[model samples]
Target: MTQMTRSAVGGRLSDDKRKAIALQALARTESIRVLAERNGVSGPTVKMKTCMSRG
Candidate 1:
């Protein structure tokens, strides 16, 4: 799992925020790297979130 941080994007996101991000990942409007960076998380983290949401 990616370490949660408090830099630009801040610490761990709320469940709602995570769900929203997962939805964004599913939308595929942006690359995983771009979405992760924009959200201050790792690409794999976003991927994992997306996968878990599907699960």
Candidate 2:
């Protein structure tokens, strides 16, 4: 599992926000690094978002 921060992606992103990010990641509109940077999180967290959405 990727290391998750307590307030990664801007002071704890909401479920909906995570979903949006996941969707974007899945759609290939945003790279994990880009999303992570934009969201103030780590690259693995972006990957986790897409993975967890499928799980």
Each prediction's TM-score against the native? 0.78, 0.74
* CA lDDT, candidate 1, residue 32: 89
Instruction: Estimate the Cα RMSD of every predicted model relative to the unseen true structure.
Output: 4.0, 4.3
Q: Which lDDT value does model 2 have at 52?
A: 95
* Tens digit of per-residue lDDT, candidate 2, span 1-55: 1345534434478899889888989999867888777777777677888899998
What are the lDDT scores of the predictions, listed in order? 0.79, 0.75
- Quickly count the clashes in candidate 2: 0
lDDT accuracy of residue 15 in candidate 1 = 89
Once fitted onto the true fold, the runs of candidate 1 whose alpha carbons sit more than 4 angstroms away are 1-11
Best by TM-score: 1
Top candidate on lDDT is: 1
Give one digit per residue, the lDDT tens place, for model 1 in 1-55.
Answer: 2444623343367888888889999999999888888888777778888999998
